[model samples]
Target: MTSGDVSLETVTAAKAGDRKALEDVLAGLQDRIYSLAMRVLVNPDDAGEATQEILIQILTKLSTFRGESALSTWAYQIAVRHILNARKLRDRDLGLTFEMFATDLETGLVADPPAAPDQALLLNELRISCTMAMLLCLTLELRLAYVLGDVFEMDHAEASRILELTPAAYRKRLSRARAEVIAFTSQHCGLVSNQAKCSCPRRLPAALKSGRIRSGSYPNSAGASVDYAAAKQQIASVVDDLKTFKLQQAVPGQMCPEDIRGRLTRMLSHPL
Candidate 1:
């Protein structure tokens, strides 16, 4: 899954002390691991540290691979769990609710785009900025479940496994998350809904001036899209109404500050 080649054999080999198999699994998962952290932590620097810790945890626990879950699923469990704990200790709450978002949007306190070039590159930066900031507004648990289940398009069972919750509990979390986010966007966020005044294009100028996104590397290379049809079924129509739009799945490029594999591998070379 993600980038890791999945097979019963690789899991068995990894469990049987095959270092190469373990490395291979990590190699395939490195991007996804960082990507998850980027979404959960909402800060690239924190995400980098979380990736290092997650890899180490996986490495130390490789022998315990029970095969009940896919290797990627197991890895994701470690990542999400670790992030939840880290966020609790760090106290980085977004303090956002539907009320706040609606108020901000209706009052026009959100992004104030200045004069700037209207290009796809600038648009990418705006998307990244708005999405990341919006994620910050949600509660920690809600944000993780929403990202895993909705944005990344992980099924309920798989997302639940990663969150170490039963299917029912996970489903409720995901539903609530989707409802709140969808309702807010329907009334506010310009990315998916129309009522709100702020959109990515309108905000890119201000983001550029504040150094939120750099000029170069602002535009992300076109990425393959994930199927959110299942998540769509769970969420209401606000997101599904978007046609050929990137809002549902597109994230800003350059959200990750470093190459996850390189950073973690380098960290592993050092002693505790």
Candidate 2:
């Protein structure tokens, strides 16, 4: 859904008060909005609320579509704006910085953590949550740059447009983000560096103790195993400094709540 996945006919139909056509358009945007929100917000509850707000804006603003940009890009621009300017989530209230996060990572390490039969799944969940948390260490601007340019692999032109920045400015932001993230991971994450102290198994005990990940709270499928060795190999298999972003991107996106669709459907019954 890069430029214009939604057809002009559909956009026109949506703008003209066609309920079915509008749902079609909104459905296409839902997963993407939710995914972006999840990355930016980290907390599921926060991401879900932000997703709904962004979708409502898109729904109310559908008539403003001029077709100058891809519908996806236009909607993404809205999402990026909301994320950058939105109020902070509870998890973010900690004001996590790289230095503080580094210390936190070092605080809990179990040489022989408790073992579970579902060890693979536990590691996968930890990998997802831990990597997602890393993005919080960056400022909103830097995080968006890293997610769009580095994680999602969007072109500089498109990413810059979405971020409302010049290509050069976006590039510089991404470069700084890339360097900062890479330095942190390479120095503290065992997945990207042999010298790092944190490993999924080593941190699992602390994570559970701290309620970072609770029993029965794992997403349907957290993701494939991402032990330090396997994650390191996965990174080595990709281009440089993508280890963190690759892991971040691999976490399954939050599914848009079904009630959102129903709510929007009911809204269509009223005057816009």
TM-score winner: 2
Give the lDDT of residue 272 in candidate 1: 25
lDDT (tens digit, per residue) of candidate 1 on 1-272: 22235576776676666666666667767677878887767666677878778888887887777777777888898887788777553565557666765554344333554544546555655555556666666788888888888788888888998888999999999888877776666656665655567665565555565676666654332342322232223233434434212454655323334466666556545442
Clashing pairs for model 1 are: none
Off by over 4 Å in 2: 1-3, 88-93, 220-232, 236-240
**Can you list the residue pairs that collide in candidate 2?**
3-70
The TM-score values for the models, in the order shown, are 0.76, 0.90
Q: Give the CA lDDT, 0 to 100, for residue 8 in model 2.
A: 85
Give the alpha carbon lDDT tens digit for every residue of 1-272 in model 2.
23366778888988998888888888788888887887777777778888888998998998998888889899999999888777665335457899999999889799888887767666777877888888899988898898888777899999999999999999999999989998898888767666789987898888889988776667623544445446656776776567766656565556777776678777778867
- On lDDT, the leading prediction is 2
Ten residues in a row with the worst lDDT in model 2? 220-229
* Stretch of 10 with least lDDT, candidate 1: 224-233
- Superposed by TM-score, candidate 2 places the C-alpha of residue 187 at a distance from the truth, in angstroms, of 0.8
Score candidate 2 by lDDT: 0.80
